[model samples]
Target chain A: DAGITQSPRYKITETGRQVTLMCHQTWSHSYMFWYRQDLGHGLRLIYYSAAADITDKGEVPDGYVVSRSKTENFPLTLESATRSQTSVYFCASSKGVPETGTRGYEQYFGPGTRLTVT
Target chain B: AQSVSQHNHHVILSEAASLELGCNYSYGGTVNLFWYVQYPGQHLQLLLKYFSGDPLVKGIKGFEAEFIKSKFSFNLRKPSVQWSDTAEYFCAVNPYGGSQGNLIFGKGTKLSVKP
Candidate 1:
C-alpha cells in the first residue's frame, strides 16, 4: 500500500481524445519514469522527472507529455491519443543513481495502465 | 545508439529443470545491468543487478546473473526452476554518466514452466 501506484488501470478512448495516466509513489524518490511496453519493442522510456519541476524526454517522447508538479506525482498526458499510443504504460521511481563509491539503486514499478485507443 | 538484446523470445521448461536466459547490450563505456521479472498481472520486480563489484551477482528466488564485460553480456540462470517461476523476464541497461533514470530495456523473454 505504500509503493508506487497507477490510476485507471484499464482505459479505452477514441483517436484524437486526450488521456492522462497518473502515477504516485510514497517513497519520495528523486527519479521517476514513464515507459510504454509494446510487443517486439519491449519497454521504451517515454519521459522522466529528476525531481519536482524537472522533466525530460526519453527514447520515445513524440506524442507524450509528462509533468511532475509534485515529487510524489508524475502524470503522463497524451495530447491527442492515437492508435499507436495504445499500449501498457508503466510508472517507476528510484532514489538516485549510485554515485562514485556508492552502491546502486533499483527502481520500483507501478501496476501499469493498459490503454486502448480506437 | 545503445540497446539491449534478449536472446530468447519464449522459453518452455518443466519443473525442476535448469534455466538460463541470455542478454546482451551494445553500449560503450561503463554500464549498469539489471534483470527484472514480471509475474502475471503484476509489476516489474528486480531480480538482480550488476554495478561495479563482482561479476556474479545472486538475486531473489534463487536467481543469479553473471556480467561478462568482455562480451557485453548478462545471463540469468537458475539451477532448478519451479512452476511458480513462469513469467516474463526483462534485461535492462543504463550507461554510466547518463541520466539516472534512462534505462534501455530488452524485448523480454517469456518463460513457461510446466508443472
Candidate 2:
C-alpha cells in the first residue's frame, strides 16, 4: 500500500490506437521513469520526469509521451500503438540524493504492466 | 555511451550449489553498480549497490557482489542457492559523473535452481 503501483496490469490494444499506462507512487520521489522491457533489449528507458510538469526523453522515446501532472503520478502515453511497441512496461521512482559528486538515484519499481498490440 | 553486458543469458544449477553471475560495464568515468532480483511474480528489488567506499557489497538473501575496476566488472555471488532463488537477475550501472540517473541494465541472467 505504500509503494509504486501501475494500473491495467494487462492491456490489449489494436494497432494505430492510443493507449496510456498509469503509474502512481506513494513515495513523493523526485524522479519518475518509464521503461519498456523486451526480450533481448532488457529495460530501456522511454521517458523520465524530474518533477511535476518537467519531463525528458530517454533512450527509446520515439512513440512514447510522458507527463507528470503531480508528484505522485507519471503517465506514459503511446501516441500510436504498433506491434513493435508491445512490451512489459515498468514504472519506477527514485528520490534524488547527492552523496558524492554524483547524484544517487536509487529506484523503486512497480509491479509492471504487460501490454499486447495486434 | 554507457552499456552493460551480461554474458550469461540462462543458468541452471542444483540446490546447495554456489552461483556466480557475470556483469561488465563500459565507462571511463566513476560508476555505481547494482544488482536487482526479480522473483517470480514480484517486482524488481535491490539486491545490493556499490558506491565509492566499499567494493565488496553484501545484500539480502545471502547475496553479494564485488566490483573490479581494472576489468570493469561487478560479479554477483552466493555461497549456495535455493530453489526459491530461481529468478531473473539484472546488473545495472549509473555513471556517477553523468547527470542521467537512468541505469544501463544488462540483458539479465535467469538463474534456475533445481530442487
The number of clashing residue pairs in each candidate reads: 0, 0
Docking class of 1: medium
> Which consecutive 10 residues in model 1 chain B have the weakest lDDT in total?
B94-103
Clashing pairs in 2: none
Expressed as tens digits, the lDDT of each residue in B46-103 for candidate 1 is 9988988899999999999999999999999999999999999999987776764577
- Every candidate's lDDT: 0.92, 0.90
* A17-72: candidate 2 lDDT, tens digit per residue: 99999999998999888988988888999988889998888999999988888999
Best by lDDT: 1
TM-score of the first chain alone, every candidate: 0.96, 0.93
Error of 1 at B25 (Å): 0.8
